[model samples]
Target: MIKIPFIVSARAGKLLGRENFSNPEGAIIELVKNSYDADAKSCLVVFDIVFKIEKDEDGIDKKILNNDLSNIYIIDNGEGMSKDVIENQWMKIGTGNKETEFISKDKRVKTGAKGIGRFALDRLGFKAEMWTVSNDNNGFNWKMDWKQFDNSDKSISEITADLSDNDINIAEFLKTNFNHIKINNLFNEVSFNTGTVLKISNLKDDWFEKDIAGVFKSLEALIPPKELNMSFEVNFQHLQKPKEFGKVETAFFNDYDYKLTAKYDAEKLSVDFVITRNEMDIDVIKKKFSELYKNTKAPYDLKTLENKVFKYSKSINELLELEVDENNNKLLKDLGSFDLTFYYLKYNVSLKEGYPFKSISQKERRNVLDKFGGVKIYRDSFRVRPYGDTDNDWLKLGARVAQSPAGAGQRIGDWRVRPEQTAGIITISRKNNPDLIDKSDRSALQENDSYEIFKNIIIKVVKEFEVDRSKILNVFFKHFKILNEKLRENEIQRRAEDLVNKIIEERKVVEEKLYGKKYNSVDLFQQKRDEEERKKYEEAFKDTFKAIDDEKIEKDNEEIVQIRGLASLGLIVSSFAHELKEIKNNFDDINDLENIYTDLVSNESKKKIEYNDGINIIKSLKLDTEKIIHWVDYSLTAVKKDKRKRGNLNFIKYFDSLSQEWKNVLKNRNIELVIKKDTKAKYLFRAFEMDMNTIFSNLISNSIDSLDMQIKPAILVKQHF
Candidate 1:
């Protein structure tokens, strides 16, 4: 954790010498608290003008009028302060009256804490004087001259002393116990009983530059009475109250009241309207509603019921009978219910006393009238405008509804009612403006365009609400749809597995028919006889060759050698015949073996076996076949007694043909083959071409078998010189 150091000293001077106010209105508020503390029912502030004339050096007079300064005096008939309180509480700069036991009866209602309100006079002027009489009939008079404490050397001691006879008497009464004062001077006199008079002179004239009306209007709105019993007065006069303007009439309507009401679930919004009998003439109601609901076409046969009033008392009944006809056919049908009511209001006009009628100006009256401009909505005849006109954002109707349970008052039409259900006593005036009426009519001439904006907003909100509900339903349906699709897919997968099993069974039978049996006795016997004959032929050939080369002592021994060679040739021929017979038998055996292996490999049961098992079988079969081929080649070579030779071969042609044949073999196995030769070279004599061919053939065959087991097989054959 990071520890934050608290710098007590750094913040100590933050509020010191600060004005404790941002505007003149704040200072005035402090003064009001002082009056309340004094227990005064009413306090009046007076601004008095005192002029001083100065003469130029040329002896011509010049008027030196200071608008920045004014003499402010506050008079109240309340329990006054005594000499001790004036010195210790009133005149003291930092004395805390709130902490004193005798100063206030209610601790919660006290506004003063530092008792520094007296310093406010210091900002306006250079001096202050307090005069008062105690409520106990004890006279006390006092004067505090801040100039005496001021560092400036300016003084009016000479002027004040010349009037000492009058000033002294008033000062004695304020500073000590005295019944009355006999001062005859303008500045020295006791004016009231058990009250305090505070005079602040040499006020900064800039304080008078503010718009007093504007400030007062805002204060009135912010501080509305909760019980609707308190009335506020500004500049010693009451504010002009709101008044109803006029009743708009249409054609001759029914003598019964009509109501309209609606409720929305998503927004939790509810709206109700109460209309009185003849409150709206037929023509006016239709015209206004047409503008409000322009998107809705006129109902057919609506003229017959144009001046009629709906009679249903309950919302449910009204919804059942509700219908709109257009073009001689019913165009609108309702599915829900609504409630509404109506009434007429009388209007009276009043204005501020000194305000001019024609030249009053918008700035002077705008703040006062704007507070009551909006239509007041009510739930139970109590005002619900939060903070009155101070809150301009009229949205949050749902929020107000939520708060209604907390016992908040509702606004009844244009009146603000109390929680006790008492009506507000503030009387307002309503003045009709014929010019405004004419303007409204002229602007409404464009019937379609005039209502287009409002119509769009209503339609947008309604559609948005519907769309939200539809989205919820769509999500619900989508879940079930996905579940159904999953079920269908599972069924398909199961069928695919069954079909695959059936295919394997059928393939096994077909493979058995194509290939023969394995481990036949006939094949083993023939292979063993071939191997024995090959060995015998090799032994006989060697013996004959040894006799012919016993002693090539003389060149003439050729005849004997020839005889030996011929005898050897005869034995070789006999051996060759036997070998040929054996070769034929071995060939038959090999054919049987190939058939058995092919049958086993191509069987459906084998196809279903794992890849590793199939590869092991192929490897074993290849080893056995290679052994058999080697034995046959050895037997043939011994009988023929042929020597190994080498010959040049076109490697390109060989590889090309080999690749073509390999491709054809791979096609049967569903494998692809590619063979490449680079810089083919002729070989020196070493191994015979036939032996090489046999070796390569076995290797290629084994490679092909290995590739056949793969899903997509590819074989690459390459030869380098």
Candidate 2:
């Protein structure tokens, strides 16, 4: 069978120009990218929607232009194209010019490698006027009506545009409708003589000030911050009055609360993360912390670490070794050096309780959150679209917040910055990371093996940072727990005192009735009655005294229970605070592994490692969580009221179960724990498990403490019949 050849029709332009960009901003950005590819140092966008006011017949103010035009103009000072270049390069659909010449004469990497930037004009409007003068003194002036390309009746080759070859007088061209256009202001620079100018009309979209502002912001983030060789400025004219046109103000990654610089070295196999808090905010945070500490009476001063920037470094293999198998570990050796710089947004006003800046309500706080929010990804200095969008949560931050353990400080819920709560970007360079390339659209990174690897690494590093923050906060807030305990003690004692007073008052009333002299009777009957009343009074006195004693005993018991609870809680909190101090160890290990992975992968050998398996992390996290739970359980048990109940226990079995608990630790310590019966004690013993466990625990702790420094630390549990 013979195959019929097919040719692309002129209608294909409809797809390229109109459908290539997802939005108007995207379309406009494509033009900016074109300018960048041309090695332009500046690109300006002017909305030709000039505003005017005049008097109406009734002498009232009126806005001019009932048509409400929303035209747009893009001008750039770059190496413009000659007539031949325009005809063969710019005019041709799907030309390979940009790909063939990936680097411009100025050495700027070509962002518009697809060579279809002209389609962006189609996305803008139906009609357009273009003027360009090449550096070689040749010029091309053209006009295109994109609607002609949509005619199905015509063949693909039939689509045409008005064109000419001449010295482009940009002023004469733009002055047709925009007579007020400032020629000197736009084309005064000698370098700008040979550049491109696009005057688009028949406005497609009804753009508002907000829309223009959005476009302005996107342009600010378009260029790479690290590409010092490629310096470009973007200006926009939105309001037309006495003329309000200016450069777009961009917020760099450094314009954040926390600036984190993380680097993984290939040869050194080491990871270094430097955390710098915003210098301006140090005093505010430190004051808040100091006040918090004063309230709870925290022991150590954080001032030393507060103002100082922290740098922690470790080997990568140490972090990832226990996480992956030895054979698969080789895969990590191929990774290269990568730098991840992260910025974080702090609340405009600290929402912390007891802070001076508490004027904002919850709803207002959300408004602030919207203003300074979104954690985004930057690959080679350019943003990855949809990653940090209002709808996007690449980190699933919302899910994490929801799943965070209950009873966490409200800060953990509301104040903790989610991806949306953060306003920052991670900068990665394409030169160092060749494997992680941007997609043709340049909107995001290609979801290849490298992309997945990068994403996981980022998440792990961020999670570690998050944990570090929590650990720090836990230390600061420990005092609050102490303050709460004190308040609880005062309350519990007040209740117990009232209960004891009530018992005493109740007994006093019975004694008063027994001794009352209101009763009168005949001599004999009265004497007998008095005798009986004396006996009754005696019994009543005995019972009443006993009741008072019991009430006092109960009051004292309650006080003891309260004290025990507070002490237990203090122990747990103290241990946790200490652990938080050492929390760096856990994450330092991970960092160590990360460095090794980087060194191995980035080494000359180009090794490969499988470090994406998160199971090890899960296992480690689970073990830590279980330990915390056990601490809490012990605290809760200390305060429980019904723990003195008797239970029959098989001492042998109990010892066996307890021995199993220490088996792993014993093995790790190179010691064996042996449990034996000193005698044939077969009979069951009635005792409180609480008391038994307490006694056994003390003995075990003592033995372990003494054996800790020994060559082999062993524990022996025996039942002495």
Candidate 3:
């Protein structure tokens, strides 16, 4: 065999850089991730905006003009490259030292397995200057103009980047703590023992305020979640006019009305996704609830309702957990169980001054929330690009909600909560999961079953969360109603005061009568009139409050009955998945499933199973189909009440109905749910049927969660007379 030297094409950089990075922001993210893999403690992205002001042909006024010259500098205090490494690893295309060194000095798993991050610098601009200092050497510098890529005659091997060992300038710079300020200074004099810097000039495109803002937001997403050991600070600045850009402080994810957390099992299954109630908000809610239920008597048990206030436990500020079903977790086995935390500002983002919020304006804070809001995916402490885009609804939340007719009605209510309303990050570890493969180009995750299942799980969980939230937010609506009632009371009081004044004027006129007996009679009549006015005003105030309460109850009832369709959809999908799993399991036992079908159609010699088996298979298929239909009917029945009716409900009958609904789920999970009343009393209690459903469902859900953690689990739902 004759061996020949391999020749690489010159257009490789164009293919790797231009085609690899979906956008400039995508390229920037790769470089930032490179910094992270190097164990960076802090990364600074300096957007050195250049400007020139000159008077136009008219000499009176100065106008700002784009010099068409702006530089982007990314400096990181990470492990820097040495001279030899620059030639062998840094300059090499589609290859890097990260593969051999799979972990950092901090034991962080390396994410640059494909080694395409070198393309990031190329993606940023046509010209680049790299200055790096490592403990192995004093300094190493490299400069390259990518215009060589335009030459059709040259191969990638023919296109050699010029690199040099700069012991004079860079060594002195490193010796001076990386602080050698140039006369035309463009970057900060960062003091670090070892670091790397990339100055990208002659940018591929113009850098505007929006692009800078987008870059800032993207950089924020690049920083790994605080829960990771790989936490780093990212800060951006304007080199020309820093003050005009304002003080850009590094911020952590904080401002939120609701925080949701999903805890997964060892199998990467989402065991529970908790939509938590803020304890501070809960405390205020408790006070308001106390006022509402102060003396509320028969037909409504305020004590029981108060106990379940906003799904909170009796403890101070503890999170209320939303228990997930086992069927929802089957696909997570190989996906690697990870934590996904989401923060929802909801409509409450408008609230005034609090910690973190007090320092920032409402506009700036809103901008931050809107910009950063999306479910970003992270693998081995590095973010996957394009998944959290404003235009990309990876979770398909809006589509799913809009499709469901149950979601506040398409005619009057706007129930669409877009992906931007929520900001979240999912932490997935590569060490634990070998199946999660970052694509060759390192642009996105592999489009496999694991990814599809992962996406499905999140949307389903979120849909449930939205439904639960809609119910909980009714508390705020009720609070608003109370405020409106207060306003009405004020108006009624004003009218009563005006009437009282008129009566007093008449009394004054009557008392001015000449005769003493006549004056006394007029005074008595005036007093009687005053008492009637007082009585009338009290009755009017009472009636107005009663009307307000009636309105509140009616609205609450409407919300519960017209329940969000997403919740039902999520459950339907969950049940459907379960049925499919069962069908597959059934088929798995039949080794001759394919042969059985063939045998039933023809007079074949020998098939593995008899023709009768085909009939059984068909019957099983029909049964599962009916099971799916049963659940669909059940969901509709649960929410299809024509009108809100208030009356006594028999405890035994209600529990029986609830148990029947959950029997299959309980049985499938090998869980024993025993529903026995404390007494033999056949007592009936006053409550809406919908209220009972909420209470029982939550109880069942919590019990299921506890049972999942046990080998043999049981729950007792005992009601007292």
Candidate 4:
């Protein structure tokens, strides 16, 4: 057995001035909450401001002014209350109907709690009336005067309503005053039905002062409900349909989608985001935003708050989209959808709670919200603002407003609106929205856990896109092969360069030993020898050494140049392999030139030809003269020598090889490569196979290094000669 404890309060502290609304906005929100608790599918709020002439104490005729008259009506189709319920629940103060065991037929419990919600009506109008009809019992009608509650001298009887109203004129007046409440004067009606209506009158003059219509417009646009499916109108004209805040128009490289939408309201700033499925690989969105808004300081210096907001908003799709398994099947039989909306409002620091009335601590306020502010998240939408308490830092200070009510909170757990209750809320508040434009949460940008998750998702998507395992494996093999080939080429180039340098040094030593005595002797015997003989010998020696040094330098330079060229070629080959593997693991037909190069490199062929013989042979060939001409032209091009003095053979080769290996890895991962080159060139001098290989490897490795990781993983290589 259990007993309920009863508490009592003195009547002196019971009633106060009707205008204890604190603010007009809060008063309106209370009314809206009531409609929602009643399970109203749609609620409409209309503001009406009526003007009349009144006389002052001096008997001077003065017109009492009004802003608007048609805006003071709030209509809903929820379950209307009976006359008795209206008197006890609607008119009476401190009566707890929400605690009663009144459950709807659908088994859905009510959301309203505090008995003081009706008291919020005091902010709207001076005089008020309520008309309702229930179908479960005999039909009845009733109305209450707000002015009566404020009149301390008036007895309770005067404030109470009489259900007996049968006069035709009185009925007409009631009908005119309460259009939302349907009733006939001929018979009393009272029954609990499926629909309910509420009409309020005697709107406060200040109700129209804050632009009620504008507020509704903003609310409708900002928070479009999917469950209740709301519609709003000004006067008789319906409001325009709300548009999505962010939409991706262009697909970026790597199939990453980018979307951005921004709104600026004096001191309030907001940005919406959407990223492509794969684009989540990198956490660059926050970086990009920081760069964009770096010039402006964070409104409240609330780094944590800003970060939470950005992260939550950016990953909205993840919350709404269904999860899929490796087989591309939905993980859950039923999926949930979510819609998030962020609001930012700015107010004076002095208005905030816990701070001095004359001076408020902006840092403290921001810190408080960053710690705990705005609405908590649920699965589909926010629970509502101020879920835990009204002591939020930002809200207390009147700085900002954020409403996201998803997550573990009970206030927003309405199954009718959110069928799958697996959502969370993230609300952030700042001193001024404009501050966000300048200040950023550097900590959020540094965090990489979320990025790791995003990368895994991208990898999964890539795997799904590539269904043919054989093709994927082929690409892997081809990439590996190209990488190995590039590594070999790089080694050959390094060896060639070293050998060229050694050969040049040896040649220099031989030349110096051979001509050293002859040159010295000639200088000494210049007067004794024949003039023509001396001149001819000197000229010949000078020309011979110059040509030798030039050849040596050119060979060394060729080794480096060729290595770079080969690296580029290797990258192209890897890309081609990736493409071929992706398209059924079949390679494109090799061109005759490519085949010739492959055979030349693979096979040892030592065919010596004089300069004249080579020229004659090219002329004799009838096949495409252009090809031969191009080959000859390329052969004439000069090669550049290595400029760096340090010679770390292993390091150079290792770096070149690593570059090629990375390219191969990318190809294995399903990347593509393309290559373009000028006509092939012939070598005039004999060169080692190692040298050629090294040149090819270095060139290809460099090209592979330039490939972008985010793009379709493709590389393009172009060679001049």
Error in Å for residue 343 of model 1: 18
Off by over 4 Å in 3: 1-6, 49-70, 168-190, 225-230, 244-253, 266-275, 279-288, 291-331, 348-365, 404-420, 438-443, 470-721
**Tens-digit per-residue lDDT, 597-708, candidate 2:** 5565544434323434433564576556545444444544443333455778777776775676555555545777887774456747887766876788788777777775
Model 4 TM-score (2 dp):
0.32
Q: Tens digits of per-residue lDDT for model 4 on 627-701?
A: 333333222211112212233233333333434444444454456545443334332333433454457556655
Query: Candidate 3 has which clashing residue pairs, if any?
Result: 9-156, 10-156, 268-337
For model 1, the stretches where C-alpha displacement exceeds 4 angstroms are 1-18, 50-69, 92-96, 99-108, 147-192, 207-367, 371-721
Tens digit per residue, CA lDDT, model 3, 290-368? 5654655521234543343222211101121324556434445666666677776543333532211112345755686
Candidate 4: what lDDT?
Answer: 0.38
RMSD of 3: 21.3
Worst 10 residues of 4 by lDDT: 414-423
Q: Report how far residue 176 has shifted in candidate 1, in Å.
A: 24
Candidate 3: C-alpha lDDT: 0.63
Regions more than 4 Å wrong, model 2: 1-6, 49-70, 153-158, 169-191, 208-214, 220-230, 239-246, 253-257, 264-270, 278-307, 314-338, 348-372, 406-417, 429-431, 434-443, 498-721
Evaluate residue 488 in candidate 1 and report its C-alpha lDDT on the 0 to 100 scale: 49
Q: What is each predicted model's overall lDDT from 0 to 1?
A: 0.39, 0.63, 0.63, 0.38
Worst 10-residue lDDT window, candidate 3: 311-320
When 2 and 4 are scored with TM-score, the better candidate is 2
